[model samples]
Target: MSTNLFSGARKALVASIATAVLLGGVTLVTTPYAAASTTVAAVSVSAKINAFTNIDWLNGVWRTGAGFSIPATAANQAAFKAGASVRLADGQVRTISRQQIVGANMSIFLDGAKLDGNKVGAPQVVTIGSSVVTAPVTSPTTVTAHSTSINAFTNTDWLNGVWRKSPGFSIPANDANKAAFKVGASVKLADGQVRKVTQVQVVGANMSVYLDGAAVNGSVVGAPNKLSTAGTTTATPAPAPTSPTTSVIATSNLNNFTNNDWLNGMFRASAGFSIQASSANVAAFKAGALVRLADGQTRKVLRQQVVGSNMSVFLEGAAINGTSLGYPKTVSVVSTSASTPSSPALTTPPATVTPAPAPSAPDTTNGKPLLVGVNLSGAGFGPSVVPGTHGTNYTYPAESYYKKYADLGMPLVRLPFLWERIQPKLGTPLNTVELARLKQSLDFAQKHNVKVILDLHNYYRYFGKLIGSNEVPISSFAAVWKQIVQEVVNHPAVEGYGLMNEPHSTNGLWPQAALAAAQAIRTVDSKRWIYVAGDRWSSAFHWPHYNTQLISNPWMRDPKNNLVYEAHMYIDKDFSGNYFDKNEQFDPMIGVNRVKPFVDWLKQNKLRGYIGEHGIPDFSPSALVATDNLMSYLRQNCIPSTYWAAGPWWGEYALSLDVTSGKHRPQLPVLQKHAKTAHSCTSIGPL
Candidate 1:
């Protein structure tokens, strides 16, 4: 799960500038925060390497390096190093040449023939893991409506493929609707919500009608017979008066809550929440059941989970007010009044209820592979140096780099950086120096019409501590990401957040940690994509072994429906980009085979996929064949990828795509061939 590490630095800047935020129309011009001076524990490679071995690397060839023998004692483990003779479990002595974490043991190569006796030879993998609007019609009004017959085009973009807009609704993108649902026009919902058709999203099979962000019954959706000449309006209906009675059935003490609940149409905890529960109360508040709460809110129960003496209940409606549910106070749960509006329960009595569709992977790419790009490395280098000196220790891609790549048809660039350098300390504002550099690179990419992935290239560790460890709490991870997103919230060139560069040895906590950070990011920006990598170095070959969540229960639950899983693949004996053996031959399908599990997993789970890192060193013609084959396979699957990489400091590196004399590298051409395929596939507006 390791890649070649590099170093660079960020120089502080003091200035104010305007930047566009994503997901809406807002811009901010603010001064940068000064860098902070702090000390952190130096990384312990043995601890890190030991953690990586916890997973089974049945697909050994895809791991970073190799190891052979097991260390029998704590001293032996500490003494372990390349070229050190280590005692095996059988007491046999073996010299360690190259070692990598491969599923609960190090896969070592002794003198290059590659014999990883730790069950590393086969594929022992198992697996795991928006809007609408409307308007009216006219002029033979190219608009037509069917109440519920035509299902809105479903894609991986939204759950049930629903593109919902509050106060608005979505309709099938049939020919007549496409012509009639024009922006600036108005559509009146069957209930009398008059909304302006703000925009239209036509990508592959998805042609959505946005009614300035509204939701309505599909049957009532259609073009208005005529245009409205005034401001938007919603017909209000007089409330039916009733003397509803409330009977207190149960009361419980509120323990805690969070605001990131995912309940749709149901009243959800705006922040997470928990209450003491016993067997008696758990059943009384089952899904689809309605109850009146002291907060003056009535909602249908979505679901409930009980662990120990605590229960978490999700309800459908507007977000619940956590503050109103006073802690340490007994909250009354009352029987619903006959006078209050109600819907059938979400569970039980199937004949009377239709539960909301479970969240599904959005078909964002429209069955076509996403766009191809290259890793613009450098900013993430020099992990050992905190707030490293810019230029000497680290650097970001220049404007020319973006220009050259965009000109070459590579419209995406995955930019990696150390989380430590940006924030310096957890829960603190980002260092102005690092922030300015990142913004500069983003601006350059946007100018070139290229999308960028802001990769937190910290290897799932901040300041040398694995995330979720006491030293690095998961909340800190979420906090950093939340702040980062706030800084660039909706920068147009920003594609997604590479949550981590390559995570390894996360103690089975990566999934929870990753999701926590994602939820935090969503709190600020919900429209941008979030690229999640698997544990065990995010290896496509070993994805199933390291990440074993069932497809039925995906680990990622993005509130915004833009979560894309990422994996890395390198075609070499060790799956490391070093390529020490220059003349090694490779099967043309080697690259494809290594990455197939990841692709297949994505398919089985119905999720989006991305190849975050894949590279072949020069000097091996067969590697080129393998690279080309892998690229073709990705194109056929409609998955996007970024080559491993092009940067300013990678002088003479085998896999470096850093340009020289204005000439393109051999690998660049291979990537270029697949880059243009996504261009015509789907358009979600701009990068």
Candidate 2:
């Protein structure tokens, strides 16, 4: 059978043809994908006889104004439809397949007869039939029937092939989840009640399931009841409540977190945390376990502390965008109903789990925070010029710039450099000139006690080909990382190796490729942290959509447990650092809202996180507020962040923190204020 080769854009407009169109007896089972843009139900069209001439060969189906029948079996039909050889009247034979259909520009005749073998004429095409199917309206909280694929224990996002493995759970993509969770293809629930996916949210790791715009009672979908205030399933018994009581949970100075065992770890809170516990949860909490809070938040109870006096109670979950907002002013104990005789009324558990006070904290200059840093740019510019002249096409950060930021109270520097400039050839030794320039920067950082994270800002591609693709094999990618690790494994200023800066379109191979690169680094240096960025530009907002495999246990294994996931976010209109609009308005909460997904994912996986890059343009005052808010949020959660940039060449760049005309940029004061509060970095452990 002949077919019209539609362009990718035109293909989206084509829908399934319900009725069988007999073209020499070939049956069109289904179209490529149904049109989802329309809300009206699609109407099917009756079959009609059509014909055409001149045909292409060995690339796709080849026929001219003729009809043919394919084999009845699925396998036979696929093979026959794939390609077939036919003889022309001139004794020339041509094979047909689906490769060269691009730009074929063939036409179909509305009325024609089945041609006998060897009848050749101008190249002809037969446009496939299309009919739209009923689809639901698309809205902020509601998804179309064509887009609803999530079920009780699974979601449409997990099945999108971008994630190679599952996290053993599925949650809808809502404003809270922000993995940019998209249920792109069509799927149906076993109950058939999920015709249209309505509102559902993933706050932290807990998911509130919904179906057809109605709340689901139990953890399972299609349940026949609503959730009660007790936060129990309809099948489970309610717990007994006591009363809301006040207690002096902690009385020590508020600044005592310096050596606190819990606060030393990332995302760990010292006080202002409580959960309505079940019997199992109570046992888990008392044993210093990771308990899921009644409100669907999760935290590992490493230790609980009480150190203050006359602490009035605030019986509410203290969280910012679903993360532990550190140290509430007062502590309160709210009584909770017990589900069983063994379960006690919800009260503050005894603080018996505290381990020995953390070892002497790392040396700090005036007790400056560990992760306050600036992104040192320059080496990564001029992507089109490979192995270009250093001074003209690209340049490394000036030695003085490192000391300037370090002396200005920034203790860390993220150095971005091109991979091609470093190696010149893939899988080869580092270029000596580039290597020397990098070492010089490291030396300057060491002199000023400033940590450095080397960023490979390649955007998951080298010479325009994505890593893990045929042109750039994962082995080559891993090899380069291994060599770089070997060189700086002993450098005192080297904080860690950023595997890649904002990897995008890695074709779902990011998890595998990152793991391979990390394993290679471990072969030389296992103590230092390796920052693994997620696919799709390492976007914190879209972390869940493309990075489930990286978080999935055993999918990405680092033997040393020193892996820190890196994510990037921007508060501009497009989430890109380059603010095209001079006067972009923004909500002060934009920064907090965008990074919540990555932070929540980190907390859920019990892993540390780093914001490798985030910045705001100077054009908008709201941008400054958003920046300050983001820094505050990061500080509260103990997540490290580096501003987008500071380089000698960035003379007029809005986000650049480079000192120009000896004047401080508008963002400097805000950054310095937050930098002073940083007392910890990813380097809490050895190396």
lDDT of 1 by residue, 1-687 (tens): 343331111111111111111111111222223222222222222211121222333233334444432311222222343455543333444565544321112334444343343443332211100122333322221112212222332222222223333433334333334444545556544455667766543321223445666354433442321222122222222232356766656544455332223221122423223554544457576776665555555556667766433566666544445455444333445564475444333233323223323522223322223467888877876677777888988889889889988877776889988888898888878899889999999999878777788899877888889899989999999889999999998677778898987888778888888888887988898777788898877889888888764122343732246788888988777766556565587854678789898888877666778889887765454566567667767765667889887867765555667734333344665666555432223422111
lDDT of 2 by residue, 504-598 (tens): 76778888888889889989986777888888778898887779987555745433557878888887666666565665777545787788888
Clashes of each: 73, 25
Top candidate when judged by lDDT against the true structure:
1
Task: Supply candidate 2's per-residue lDDT for 322.
Answer: 19
| Candidate 2 deviation (Cα RMSD) | 24.8
Once fitted onto the true fold, the runs of candidate 2 whose alpha carbons sit more than 4 angstroms away are 1-253, 256-369, 553-559, 659-662, 678-687
- Model 1's number of clashes is 73
The runs of at least 3 residues in candidate 1 whose Cα sits more than 4 Å from the true structure, single-residue gaps closed, are 1-370, 550-560, 659-664, 678-680, 683-687
Compute the lDDT for candidate 2. Answer: 0.52
